[model samples]
Target chain A: MNQPYSSALLENAVNEFAKLPGIGRKTALRLVLHLLRQEELSVENFGNAIIKLRKEIKYCHVCHNISDSDTCSLCSDPNRDDSIICVVENIKEVMVIENTHQFKGRYHVLGGVISPMDGIGPSDLEIDSLVKRVSEGGIQEIILALSATMEGDTTNFYIFRKLAPHNIKISILARGVSVGDELEYTDEITLGRSIINRMPFNETFKP
Target chain B: MNQPYSSALLENAVNEFAKLPGIGRKTALRLVLHLLRQEELSVENFGNAIIKLRKEIKYCHVCHNISDSDTCSLCSDPNRDDSIICVVENIKEVMVIENTHQFKGRYHVLGGVISPMDGIGPSDLEIDSLVKRVSEGGIQEIILALSATMEGDTTNFYIFRKLAPHNIKISILARGVSVGDELEYTDEITLGRSIINRMPFNETFKP
Candidate 1:
C-alpha cells in the first residue's frame, strides 16, 4: 500500500508547503500535485526564483528592514524628512502606515518590540541605532505608531527615557474609544500626553 | 515612489512569489518579509528545501511522475497488477483513486490529454509507451479513468482505438449523481447508477 503511490519527493514538497500559514495537508498535497503536473519550464521558474531570493536579498542596515542591498531606498532618499522619524516595532507596520498616505515622515524599523516575558527586551531590538540617530541632533520629533498594547507602551516608554536628554518632541497616536461600535478588546491605557490634558475617568468625579 | 524600493533581488523575489496562484503583490511582500523575519538557520532550511526540490527531485522514467530516484514506487512494486494498467490523464488523479485502496493495479500516467486546441495531440501524450506495453502483450486491462470532459472522452476514444488489437477488459468508473448533492444537480441515468449501486461512490468506483 505504501509503495502504490506518493514518492518521498512529493511527500517532502507537501511538508514544506504545509508549513505555510492557512495551508492544510490536503491543500499542501494539492499544491505539490499541481507542481508535479506542470511542464519543466514552470517548475524551473519556481525553483530559480527561490534560489534568487536567498542569493540576492539582504538587509538595509540603517532602517533594519529587509532589502535587496545595504542601504534601503527610504534611507537613501534625499526628499524624505530627516527631522521627523516614525518609530515602529516591525517593518510591516511601516508599510501599513505608508498605505494610509497620512505619514510623510521617514521610518525607523525597530525589528521587534520590548517584550520581557517573551525574552525580547530593549537590547534585543534596534533601539541603539535609533538612539544614535537621534543623538546626532538634527531629528526634531519621534512619533510612536506602535499598537496600543502593553508591550508597545513599554517600548514607547523605554524609547522616551533614552530620547529625553536629546530634547526631542515625542508623540503617540491619540486614543479614546474607537469610532466603530464594536466590543472593547482592551481598556489598558498608558496615558502619554493624554494625562496632562486631563480627562475625567470617573463619572461622579467633582470639578 | 518607484525607486523607493529598488533591487532586482527584491523584485525577483516578489515577482516569483506573486506568480503563485491567487497570491497578490501585498501577500508576496508579506511572505518575503516573513522569510526575512525567520532566523538564519530556518531561512537556510527553507532555501535548502527549494534547492532539494529543484536538484534532487526528478520524474520517474516509467510513470513520468515526480520521484526522488530513478523509477517511481508504483512502477517498481512487486504485487501490484502490471497486467492491469489504470490509465490517467495526470498524476493527481492517481492519488485520488489510490486513496480508495481499491486499486491493486499499476498505472500509466498519460502526462496530459489530446487537446488539439492547446497543441497537445496523441503524440504529445505518453501513448507510445502505452502502445509498446500493449504490443509486448502480457497486459490484461487498461481502465480509461480520464475525466468526463470532452477532451477526456476524445483522448479515451483515441486510446481505445489504438488498444483495439489487444484483448483487455476495459471498464470505467460508473457515471452517477455525486454524493451529497440535491436531485436537481443529477442527470437521469447518473442518478439511476446512484440508486442501482447505492454504496458510496468512493467505495466502489474508486480503485
Candidate 2:
C-alpha cells in the first residue's frame, strides 16, 4: 500500500531507507520516524557517518579489503604470517575469521564469489590480483575461506587452478559439523563430509 | 565480540547504523557494506535524503502532523469535515486511518500516549493544543483513535475527561475481534468484547 506520508521530506527519507537491502517500506517508515524522534545532531551525525565513510574510505592495495590507508592493518601487521593468505568473498569474512582468532594470516577479499546466475564472473573479482600476489613468491600457502556454496566452490577451484603452477600449498576450509552442533540436527551433506574428513580423535580431543 | 574493522570510518558508519532501533551490529555492517557496493552517487543520495529530511521537515501548526508548510494537507483541505477531528497517537496512525479512506475529518496527532514507564506525561504530548483546538468552538466530535493497550485506554479516558467541559461528542475506536480473524485464534479479551458489543446483523451483513 502507498504510504500517505503527509510530508514530502519524510516520504523522500523513507523511500531512500527502503532502497536498502531487506528493508521493506513499512520498516523504512519506522526507521525514518525513529530517526525523526532522535536529536537533530544525532541524526546529522548518522547521515554524515555514512556519507563520510563512502566519500573517504579506502581499500587495501595489497588485499583489496576496506581500509583507512593504502594497505589494510592486517596486511601491514608484521606479526601476521606473510606466507599464508586467507582468500574470502568479502571484508565481513575477514572480520568473522578475525573474531575466531584462529587465523593469524593476511586476507585477500575477492569482493564476491564467481556466481553465474548473478552474472559475477572471475574478472569481476580480485582473482587476478590474488594470482599476482602469489606469483610474487613469498606466500607458502593459500587458505580458500569462502562460503561452501556452489559459487564459492567454483571460485575456489578457479583460484586453485590459477595458483597450481606456483607449487604453493592450497587448502580449502575444513567441512564438518559445527563444534556445538548436534549430530541429529546436522544436514546429510555436512554429516557425510564430516565423516569422510574425520581426523584422528587425538587431534581434536583436547584434555 | 569486538569487530576488527580495518577503517575507523567503516566502524563509525556501522556504529551509527547499529544505533537505529532493531538494527544489530551484524545487520548494520551488512547494510553499510551494501551501501559501499552501490554507486557513490546513490550512497550520497541515501545520506543526503536523511540529512535533508531531518534538517527541513516541518510540523503542521494546526494538527501537529509532519508537513512541509504551517498547515498540513489534511487540515488545509476545504472538502474535509471541519466539525469532526480524529485524535491519534502519532502521524503513523493518521496515515493508517487515512489509508482506510473512512475518516473524512482532519487529524490531531498527540505525538504519543501517556506512558509513565517511558516518562511520557499527557503534558509532554500535543494534548494542550488539542484542548485549545476544541475550546475554539467549531469542532462537534472528537474520535480517540488510539491503540487498545492500557496506556491507550488511559489516554483515551484522560482526553475524554479533558474534552468533557467543551460539550463535544467524544468517541473511541471500537475494541473487538479483528476482521478476518478466526474465533479460535483470537485473544480472550477481544473475543469477549466482540460478543459483548455484537452489532445488528443487517448493519454489518453486505450480502
Candidate 3:
C-alpha cells in the first residue's frame, strides 16, 4: 500500500514524472503505471511531445509569446490594430484577453513581472522592444493589462516612465466589481473601490 | 486570454499530456509549458524514461509482478517459505504485506479480480498458472488477501472451487474493526461481525 514493488524501469519512470512541478511520488507512480498500460505507440507519442516542445518551440519575435514560428498569428495579422498594443506579463495573459473578443489590437508579452525577491528586473522584460515599436510611429495607445499585484504595478510604472518621452497615450484596465460578482461575497478592498469609483447609471447601461 | 495561440505542435503536446489519467486540459498546458522552460537535455531525459519503460520493462514469469528480469527478487530469494503462498490482486498488495514483515511466505499475484461488469473474467487473470503452481505439490497453505469487495468475494469463491481437490489449507483475512477504528464510526456489518467473532483477550496480546 505504501510502496509499490521494485523494478528499475518503473522507478526510473516514476522519478522522472515526480520531477514535474506539483507532482508527488504517488501521483507520478500512478501516471507512469497508467502509461505503462497504454499502447507503445501512444506512450512514445507522449514522450516525443515533450521532447519536441523543448527542442522546436520558439517565441514570437514581436510580442515574445511562445509560438511554433518566429512571428505569432496576432503579430502578423493585417486587420489588427498595430497602433494599440496590449502589454501583459506572459503568453497566458494574451490568451485571457483574446477570449473576451473585446480588443482587436496586437500584444507585447513582458515574459514576467519585476519581482525583486525573484531577481526579476526591468531588463529581464521586453520593455526596450516595446519602446522601439512605439517610437516607429503610428502607435497611438498602449494598454497596461497586467495583474493587480505589486509586481504588476511596478512593471506598469517602469514601462510608463520609459515610454513617456515617446509621447504615446498610455492607459490601464479599470478596477471594479467583476461582471457576475455579488457585492455581499466580494472582498472588502474590491467592494470599496467599486463603490468609490461607481459609474453613472446611464454610463453603466451604454455598454 | 483563455485560448493560447494556435500551433499544431503545441496543441499536439498539450493533447498528449491531457491523455494521462487525472490530468485536465489546463494542467496539461501547465505541464507542457513547464517542460518547455526546462533545459533541453532534462526534457529529453524525461521523454527517454517513458520510451525505455515501454521498450524494456518485463513481468516476472513466476508471480506476474513487474520486474526488470524474468524472475522477481522475492521468488529468487532462498530464505522465503516455499509451501505457503499469499494470494493478492496486484504488486501493490504484495508491497503492503511485505511492509508488515509478519507473513514470511511467498506471494502469487492474480493481476486483477474477477469483474463481469468490466468484462474481466477468470481467463483474464493468471488463474491457470496459479492452479498449476498449487498442483505441483509443495504448497501447504494459501491465504486469500484480496480486497473486501463483491468482486473480491467472487474471485475467492471461484478460486476455492478450483483448488478444492488439491487438499491444501485455505484461509481468508479476518474481517473486524480496524486498528485505531472507533466503534461509532465503524460500519454496522463490520461491527456485528467483529462482535460475533471476537478473539480471546489473551490471544489478542499474542503476536
TM per candidate, chain B: 0.84, 0.97, 0.93
Which pairs of residues collide in model 3?
A: A95-B1, A95-B2, A96-B1, A96-B2, A97-B1, A98-B1, A99-B1
- Candidate 1 displacement at residue A34 in angstroms: 5.0
Ranked candidates (TM-score, high to low):
2, 3, 1
TM-score of every model?
0.76, 0.97, 0.94
Which candidate has the top score in TM-score? 2
Docking class of 3: medium
lDDT of 2 by residue, B1-207 (tens): 799899999999999999999999999999999999888898898998998898888999999999988998999999999999999999999999989988899899999999999999999999999999999989999999999999999999999999899999998888888889988999998888989999998988653
Every model: iRMSD: 4.3, 0.7, 2.4
Q: A38-62, model 3: which lDDT tens digit per residue?
A: 9999999999988988899989998
Could you tell me the TM-score of candidate 3? 0.94
Docking class of 2: high
Clashes of 2: 0
Q: Going through the candidates in order, what is the number of backbone clashes in each? A: 1, 0, 7
**Model 1 per-residue lDDT tens digits across residues B1-207:** 222244567667677667666677777777776765556566566555655665567677877766677888877879888888899977778887888887898888898889999999999999999888888887888899999878998998999989887877777766767768899878887788668877765776653
- Per-residue error for A38 in candidate 1, Å, reads 6.3
Poorest 10 consecutive residues by lDDT, candidate 1 chain B:
B1-10
